[model samples]
Target: MTLKLELEQYPFVDLSAKVAEIIEDRFAIVLKSKLTLACMYLDPRFQCALDENEKKIAKSYLVKLHERMEIKRLAKLDASPDTDSRSNESDNSNTRDENENLLEKMLQSKCNQAKNSHQKKILQLLNEFDFQSERTPTGIDIIEFWTNNAASRLELAKLAAVLFAIPAAEVICERDFSTLNFVYNKLRNKLNDESLQCIMFIKSNEEIFQMQ
Candidate 1:
């Protein structure tokens, strides 16, 4: 369990996601992971042979796992005046305890390390432009674009959104690349701008252009 949790850490979030996609086992593993936590008291033998004591212990362990996951979920809610004050306080404590999520720490550390050069460059450029800190433009869009497009520090962020939205991307790319290569290769020496356009039309199976 500790190893699984550790494997889940850092600027390395997409590692787990990529592995999960590659193996197609993340979902199946999660389902069985919960079962394993409760496996201690769950005898493989028939229940008819077991007494009430063993059954009770097995049920208790399973319930405990659900309770742990549930408490963590409830902790993420915004504080509300209407919230049950007692449960809300308990959730807050449980939330803090569960927040040992090490991924955030690793990401921040990596970002800090990467920032040394980029930040220095930004400061130097600003100084060169005669823009003092007070006059410098600071906005969310500017920073977002700088980090995402310029520095490329946040490229994994773009990929994470894509990975979550589209599973099994590697397989799709693998299947299409062969067809693209065949189309391009067949046009080799015969290819000029006009004929290349025609080949692309043929490659994409646009029959109207082919007829023309």
Candidate 2:
């Protein structure tokens, strides 16, 4: 029979030369007669620059690289959760400790609260209280009486406690992001890869890049 027919029986031998034999087997007939069909239909200059084996090898490298990268991505994305779950255990432990300590503190605080409440009730009964009237004729007298006329007086001092602690916590962080938001809008789709990287670097580490 033909050389092809003889080689076909040696499947095991051809299997060793897998990619090469596959290309030859698939394209031999097409290369002979169908060449005229492909001559003007396909670009000959690009085709002639690389042979079948070279093209196959280049494609194989890219495919293998792509497969390796995809496998790495999937491994990162689809991996099973860590069985060593310390966060839940730590949270439960913190909660348990918090509950125990809170109960103890509340119990201690309750004793002090009862004592204070009893003292307050006794004071309320002793004082000539007028719930309808806003002003006490002797505001300082009641405070002084409560403190037993101490040298350092909370009532003698008119310290208006305004609860608010500052001229606002000057949060400059959000202001920077807001300013950057305007800049980012200007560069939505206009910028390429390099310019974006340069701008981000400059924004974060301006002193590092600039000398003067």
RMSD of each: 27.9, 38.0
TM per candidate = 0.19, 0.20
Task: Score candidate 1 by TM-score against the native.
Answer: 0.19
Q: lDDT by residue for model 1 over 72-191, one digit each (tens)? A: 656767444565656677657766656645767886788677655544543333223222222322333432433454344232233223223343237746545665577558547566
Candidate 2 lDDT, tens digit per residue, 44-107? Answer: 2233433455444433333333344544767999687866664676658877788879898997
Candidate 1 stretches greater than 4 Å from native: 1-159, 165-169, 187-212
- Summed backbone clashes in each candidate are 0, 0
Task: Please give the CA lDDT of all the candidate structures.
Answer: 0.45, 0.45
> How far does residue 114 in candidate 2 sit from its true spot (Å)?
73
Clashes by residue pair, model 2: none
Q: What shift in Å separates residue 32 of candidate 2 from its native position after superposition? A: 28
